[model samples]
Target chain A: MPQRYAYLGPQGTFTEAAMRSFPGADEAEHLPYATVPAALDALRRAEVDLAVVALENSVEGSVPTTLDELATGEPLQIVGEAHLPVSFALLVRPGTDLGDIKTVASHPHAQPQCRRWLAENVPHAEWRAATSNAEAAQHVADGHYDAALAGSFAAARYGLSVLAEDIHDVADAVTRFIALRRPGTPPPPTGTDRTTVVAFIGEDHPGALLEILTEFSMRGINLTLIQSRPTGAGLGSYLFWIELEGHVDDARVGEALMGLRRVCADVRFVGSYPRADQVRPEIRRGTHDQDFTEAAAWLASVRSGHA
Target chain B: MPQRYAYLGPQGTFTEAAMRSFPGADEAEHLPYATVPAALDALRRAEVDLAVVALENSVEGSVPTTLDELATGEPLQIVGEAHLPVSFALLVRPGTDLGDIKTVASHPHAQPQCRRWLAENVPHAEWRAATSNAEAAQHVADGHYDAALAGSFAAARYGLSVLAEDIHDVADAVTRFIALRRPGTPPPPTGTDRTTVVAFIGEDHPGALLEILTEFSMRGINLTLIQSRPTGAGLGSYLFWIELEGHVDDARVGEALMGLRRVCADVRFVGSYPRADQVRPEIRRGTHDQDFTEAAAWLASVRSGHA
Candidate 1:
């Protein structure tokens, strides 16, 4: 039996494209969800063996819904990752001219990505928000709107004509997607891997964050992203979402996690998985594991009175 | 002559409510801009002396557009701030029943804040996005929609009756608004103050961020928020937005700023202003200035051979 894989969709979404790019995704039964939470819920309910969702957009940073969902409830671990270069195309129904466009629709995230292009080309068009880019294209195809800003895949799937291609304000926009599964052993360290964790401070005090960073810094782990989201307890309380360059299975990485668990009020290990981007040679330069091994050996010798 | 102030609005939006709460707002000529960038642009063009924009919400975190606008272009300094507790009311035409509601409209931010209430009360209603909460109320008053989720102030302004009150999922939701003006001397330290800065890393090397945090950690500064946003330079590059507990006028804060400037590729001082929330006594317990002064005095005595 084919494994069931869920993605954020009405089909033709950038998320579906990301799901397709995942290894072995072709052998899985594709399921479409109306929202991020819905898809993650399906995975939680065991309706799907795996779920894929867009975690971060290079242009927009992290997706808040996905981040919040991952942070709460029974733990979900990212098992794999994928990157899709994003390019929006203006989709219109057959024979709809630029002059006939009164309202342009797309997901709120997509709207701002093409702000400059829309302002320059369709200055008078009113903006409408959709649940997803593919839904926007569907609306246009269903004659609810004059045009939509969506991916080329969405235009093709929805049977719409592309009035404009590569409409994003930034030329090289990319979005990173992650494959998630029930908390389990993370994929084995692939030499070039990334670990994500959320650290909640014990108290709102000076140097609390410093203590957390010391674990990673002393171990020579480079952080790729650090974001603070309110803990919802009140103002000034936050949970730091941190992504660093190392796999949890690595000795140094394991040590850092152990140290963080000791200091943090709570620590949620999101995942340690192979990174989607091509590994830069610089990321693999140092082996903090070797340093840890040597230091442990020296400490043991000193403890045994060997000077 | 009265000064002119611009805020995100047509009028009666939560932003206007925040602006009204500012000191001397009644004496100033208030102008409403359709969006955050529009209001900031008005201030930039000298059409308004100051712009009041919502910077972050306790529930949603930072408003990316406001952060991005402040990050780019001619330097803008946050001179003051205000906090408004957010609560939404279901507004409808006088005689409309809850069951008669077919579509609910509000700004995108407002919709999510009341998600639980909407899901439980009107689960089948379609969601519509409006430019502002006030505009949503206006739509309902004009019979375009059956109801709107907006502040009670908007309900009164738009002549709609509240069908439900305090409908936000979280009762304590609060938004932090900042008053921005052209690059200028920040308000003098108020004993209880906050400093916001953006630090751009000099390079993407391991431990780069650790070095940046050291300046604050060594100075005993407490960071309130730390977020990383893409620098628009492409993948893997980011600018760190940091909020710490100290005024720029403080000796320790000045030292940290100097240290950051030396270590970071660039440092933008967003502002040092009084915090809207009450200051915790613990934040005032230690003055790093005294520490710096004592260290300097001790070093001088040793260097002069007086020890």
Candidate 2:
């Protein structure tokens, strides 16, 4: 039997493009859902073998919806990730001039990316949000809006003409998408790997956050991203979404996780997967597995008065 | 002769309030400058004996203007700090209604704090930036703008009526201000103290940041703040502004500074002063001054085969 994969789409969305770029995506069944919740729900209900959703954007930090899902819901194992260069295109009916656009449609994430561009190019246009960029392009095809901001690849599929391509206020923006499945054994550590976890503060103390950070730092692990989100408990309370270098199987990472458990109120293990960039950290001298083993041996000898 | 103090003001800005909160502020000559650079420049040229500037805000993180000044040019010692609760007010001509406002003037920092409120209350108003909040209030008094976002305390000073007070997107936002002087003896170490330093990465490496963090973590010091700013060399190049607990005089802190010198290309020491809230860290075992002293003695004896 073949694996079935679900991604946010009507096809040609950034998530779909990212999903198609995965190593084994071509051999699986590709299904499109209208929103991230729907796609992930399909995987949760076992209707799909895996689901792909955008995790973080270089220009915008983490997607709030995805962060909330990862922080709460039933556990899911992130098996892999893909990076897609995000560039938007303005899609319009053939022969439509930029001045003719009074209302523009786009997904919320894409609006901020091209805010300055849209304000400058079509100063009179009003923005309308859609579920996805490809959905916006479809709405434009159906004459719901004068223009749509979407992937250029989406224009042809939705029977719209590309008015402009590669539009962005910032250059070299990339969105990172991750593939998740029902909790299972994580893929084998690839040496160059990334581990992610959500740490909840045990109590409101001046050093709670610092304690969590020291766990990883003392073991020579490097963090790539750390975001604080309100835990809905109230103001002044926050939970952190942390991504760091190394697989949980690594001795340093495992020790750090144990340290986190002791400091945090409750520690949620998201997943440890191979890093997309494959950049390996230079393991420092005292943080190696052998170093820990040797230190433990030395401590035992001293404790037994046999030094 | 009494000392002269410089702060950003025409009068009634948040900085002035913070300056007034200082223990010896009433004994000094208060001189107001138009901008942060101007106030610091006055001190740099010895025109003013000291200067007070906002350093960081609980809600907004580090103030960019202060960070840039602290990172470069002639170094000054931060001898004391004050934390002020920030709340804004809208000042307008007497008898002016909110609907009568067509333009809003404020310092760049004030605008974002009231953006959502203004959008809901005065959707037609255009935003204008002023150098300081007090300057904005003065402009409104001069009839240059319909309204200004400033402190309520400015209303009486500028002869403008307060349209609204206590305007904030988030409550309990506190801005931390620092008092600086030309190179002098640092304040003696208080049990509760914070030391700040800026570390420049020598070369691009995967764990450069992690290594710097471990130096402090291994010694059981807690970091209160860490912000990474671009070194202006390129995108990946960065310098970190770090504030950690414990004065530079602490044995653990001294060793951590030595470790940082070995790893970083350059480390700039900012003065350590008593914490505003006076929260002391729990000194863990193996990291106290006596622990370091005893360990050194033990090593020396062992090297001489007299252990």
lDDT of each: 0.81, 0.83
DockQ of each two-chain model: 0.01, 0.02
Candidate 1 chain B minimal-lDDT segment of 10 residues: B298-307
Model 2 chain B scores worst on lDDT over the 10 consecutive residues at B298-307
lDDT of 2 by residue, A71-134 (tens): 8777676888888887999999999999899999999999999999998999999999998898
**Which of the numbered candidates is closest to the native, going by highest DockQ?**
2
Docking class for model 1 is incorrect
List of clashing residue pairs for candidate 1 = none
Residue B101 lDDT in candidate 2: 99
Best by lDDT: 2
- The RMSD of every model to the true structure, in order and in angstroms, is 31.3, 25.0
Per residue, candidate 1 scores C-alpha lDDT tens digits across B230-282 of 87877777788999887877866775665565556777788888988858424
